[model samples]
Target: MPRRLVKVFARLNPRRSPEDSLALRASVLASILTAELTILAMGYYGLITTVAVPLLTAAGFYISWRRRRERNLLIKLILAVMVVAAAVIFLRELAGSLYDTRLPLIRLFLWLQVMHSFDLPARRDLKFSLVSGLILITAGAVLSISMTYIAGLALFSAAAVAALIQFQLSEDSQRVDRVVAADPWRLAAGSFLVWLMLVSVAVPVMLVMPQSTQARLTSLPVSELTKIFSDFPSEVVNPYYREGGDPFDRPPQFSADSYYGFNPYMDLRSRGRLSDDIVLKVRSDRYDFYRGIVFDVYNGKGWEMSDEEGEDIVSSSPPFELPVDTSMPRGGTSIQSFYIQADLPNIIFSGWRPVSLFFPADRIKIDKYGSLRSPYQLTDDTVYSVVTEQPLTAGSYLRRFPRAGDPAAGPEYTALPDAYGADILEIEKLTRGLTGSYDNTYDKVLAVERYLKETYPYDLEIGPQRSERDAVAYFLFEEQAGYCEHFASAMAVMLRSVGIPARVVTGYTGGSLNPFTGLWEVRQSDAHAWVEVYFGSAGWVGFDPTPGFDMPGDASRDRDNFMLSGIIDYLGGIDFGPAGRAVSAAGAWLGRGAAWLTSVPLAQLSAVATGAAALAASAGLALRRLMLRRRQSRLATAGLSRELLRDPSLKGYLRLLKRLAGIGLARRPEETLRRFARRVSLSTGSADFEELNAIIEELRYSGRPRSDGDQRRVAALSLEIDERLREGRAATGRA
Candidate 1:
């Protein structure tokens, strides 16, 4: 090793002494704990052996540390056992059928840390253990994509900083007269500040840095970790298997209930609370139902799709056009961009009639029903743009002019199962008057939609129940109060009964608009079912039968009351007693600022902001440097010792006392330090102040020159007092 490298290593590790070994061991253990948690977050569930081996090694090390008489023998035995176990595990992994090599390698590194832990009698071994722990954490980072990993990384960063600080303090104890330990609160605060700074710097650098255009290199075939688990048996080592084997050899069965809105087969009778979690964010000129799937075949039980294959469109390149009926007249086009925030199916959601798609994929498939699907599963990272036509506008020429029939739609749209026989007749009875009341198919469809919406009340508390008859029939005649599914089903069946080709379409209702991002936030609870009648020349026209649920295009009509626009209006109209004038003035100021911002080019504004941030950072750095220099000069003039200047023991204790006084626990003039400490400890249920009092007493009475150890003890006690004070303040705030 280079001399400089050796010096750096020696500085970090130091020579192991009895007094410092305990602190080193504690630091190493903390690092190990952090590494373990990070690995767990990375989805490594086979940590039984990984955890057990380290714990056992720690126990043995503890025993060796306490009993020096048999230390050498114990060390020898531990090493021998560790070597044999490691060899066995290595050979086992080599012979195993596991496809992913990363997991086994991580396991091996974890075991190596365990072995090193037992040999941490020396400072070098402890340093090695810390490095190994860091490596394990980095490995976990490579494998994880969960948001929880951010939390894990934060925790690991704090722990690592603490460990390194403790290690350096242990090293300094050997060279300095007294090494005062830092306050835990101050240390924690400092660590947090450093973490924040790192994040701030990293974010901009990441944005500006040149990103690799090359595809990611992987040891194994690309696959989702979740899919791998779902594909293979728990006991089986190999995940890939031959398709269409024996029923017993197939992958484990997943409950149909798990995929409620996304699945082809939807059982309306099955009732459960739908999650309110945001699934997608959509930016568009107008609000529209983000259509996902289309089920053409509705049996008596539920809805499903036909087995007919979709035509695959090459979408790997940009601006992939979807197959559309050129004969159908096109209306005004709407461009929409979607950002998925949850795990959905391969289906791509868009408005009623999507014309083209822009996505990063090799191929996408489109069915006759105009449902777009990707070749791969859609994840949170998936982003796509869609351009769609406003097919059925209220004042469209196509709506006024109707064509004969669509042979292209075939008999599938009008086909009804034998199970729907009685329900079809029941629907005919309900919509029988529609034929006489309306001339056009559009008016007849609207009549059925209006009838269902007016008759049935919207309710989501419908419990799960099995019906002897068709679900739609049960909803129409029996359960009059149900959600959108029931209303849409009834309308579709009723329209079809009157010879109008209609199908129940499943997607999300128009979502709540977020004015801040100018995006519509579609949640899982927004999953809806609606009716779509084939208007020969006008194309598929969406007709929502659910009461109070308007189509996305119509959603703009109520936008002022539905979103931030409503909030602004309400704020403007409200009388706030004495604050009304102030509120109005503030609102006016904000409005002016928004107008100014809108007038300026965004790129120019971004450049100005960037320049301002850079200038501020530079100014801050210069100011900090000047302050540090002034402080050094002042210390020099006072002729204060470096040890005393660096130590915060007295200042920290005074701050703690001041904090206590603020909390109505002022120290008496006559009360001794120990007595006051004991009183405070008893009252707060904390003994932290007692240690600080002990250090103060030692510093006051002892005649001997202060040692590095004494300084460290004092610093540590000060930190403890500060931490306790912080806790008390936090608790008071919460109360």
Candidate 2:
């Protein structure tokens, strides 16, 4: 039909035009290459090399030749079969995606694009294919926040510009009166310029846009996606195993033995390595140990809860008031919010002596030793709050006051197994000199703490104790080296031998603070053990005997302030007054709303919130529409032509182009006016055409200041070109 179509079709004709075919193949190759980079960015390299590359290559080869040929039934049938297979896979994945719906949806979208890649026969189809590549790149952006995605985006942008420019130029090559086709080098340079312009605009917009604080959608289910892709054993994927029973039957115990620090039982002899995996993110005004579980009984080898089944507190709703008495005269209060990152047991970790726990659970349990446990297992989705009252043990008033032991808490706090009597004797002998060194109980506990810190070395990889000796005895008498657990156990046992009611408590130490989130990232390595001694009036006072460990009061305060300084520095240049005001107003409104809603039932509260959100959305939509309509009306009456003519240089250039067209000397579609004017001047023997061309080029391309004198010169040149063109036309007609 057209010359362009003939050229495109000739590529498929083996004997007709091998060069055209090769060039078309190169363009298709560039498009496919960039598409593969995008696919790799989405972490689908296996699929790219295995399916996409070969399929796209074959499709491109077939389509380049088939532009003007009749549709082949065999190819149509093959494409139909592929569509059917992809549909079946999509349905299967959709049905199986019970754990995460997004994974299956993304996979199905990818499959559809892959199937469509083979059927790209027309120029429109090729454009659609490139658009599909863009869609996949967007999916990759949604799936990853890594720097690799940025690199992929950059590469894809460059390749896409090149392919689109080449495609447009090739299509236009068939049109009548079109100028010389763009060379490959010119096309590549234009693509580079386009990419640079896009990046220049995009970066500023990205910097100014509000950053989201929500967890990334892609990172949320990455582990689950990895499981689907990896070649791991079935047992590793599905951890439930049946023993001599129906395979469908549930296992006897939910094995959490893999998480070393969180297990209910702790064997001191077995020194297992800890992972750096983050387990908890906490936001609180003060820093303190995130107490998980406490073990009152210490057998010779390990620590265990004396009673595995704790007493459950009966409650109809949440905000469970723990049995801990926070009304003590010397108690200091703090509020904490926790977000769990990893799957953990149904234990609620908070600062020492939690007074009130607010969660979505129906019932909660507390052991006799002040350890809080949840009614259900907690995973990454679990978020809860705790209101804790830490005793003001650091204060001068509490340290000076000599409080008697609580007889009610006597047996549980001071209880030690009879089998460890040798350990008790050794503890007493070792602490004999320090027993009478302090008159007050606080001073006595401090002395014991000082002794452990000064005498012992902290070693995570301590050797196993002898069969005859208890772990405490070995750590205190012979080894003189161990981790937090050993130091805490030794101090507690030594205090108990001297009639002080002390017990070892297990929990996480203060974690590293994240400046961006204002949350403490508590890793598995932060797991620690410390001693809590019972004081009659002041309640249980926490004391860490670990060598490098600092008390939560001073250490946490300093660290929190340091992290806050970093946050301030990060936001140094940004104006936050409006944002701060908005946040404060939102907080105040939420506080008031919560206070009012607390009296209402939870079901009603949820309904009210949903209704309120819908109403607000509707109002916002109506307001936006009204504003848009008003803006359009204003623009319609504003005289856009008059506004454009306000610039004298642009006005003069337009007038000159219009005057030239009136004389039947109009510029060609692909020709620059400067070149057109030079040709015209040679034919007409007029210098005015060249002069006018120079003035127009300067005003358009040079980006220089145009004065009144330049404007007057442009008007004079335009008149002279018009007169010369008229005279030349008359002379030609007369000849």
Best by lDDT: 1
Task: Estimate, for each residue in 375-427, the C-alpha lDDT of model 1 and write its tens digit.
Answer: 55567756667888876557445346457555446566777668568777876
For model 1, the superposed segments whose C-alpha errors exceed 4 Å read 1-259, 395-401, 405-408, 555-735
Judge candidate 2 at residue 319 and give its lDDT.
58
> Relative to the unseen true structure, what is the Cα RMSD of model 2?
17.0
Worst 10 residues of 2 by lDDT: 230-239
Model 1, residue 554: what's the lDDT?
61
Point out where model 2 deviates above 4 Å.
Answer: 1-265, 314-317, 324-326, 330-332, 404-408, 417-422, 556-735
User: What lDDT score goes with residue 2 in model 2?
Assistant: 75
Give candidate 2's error at residue 722 in angstroms. Answer: 20
Best candidate according to TM-score: 2
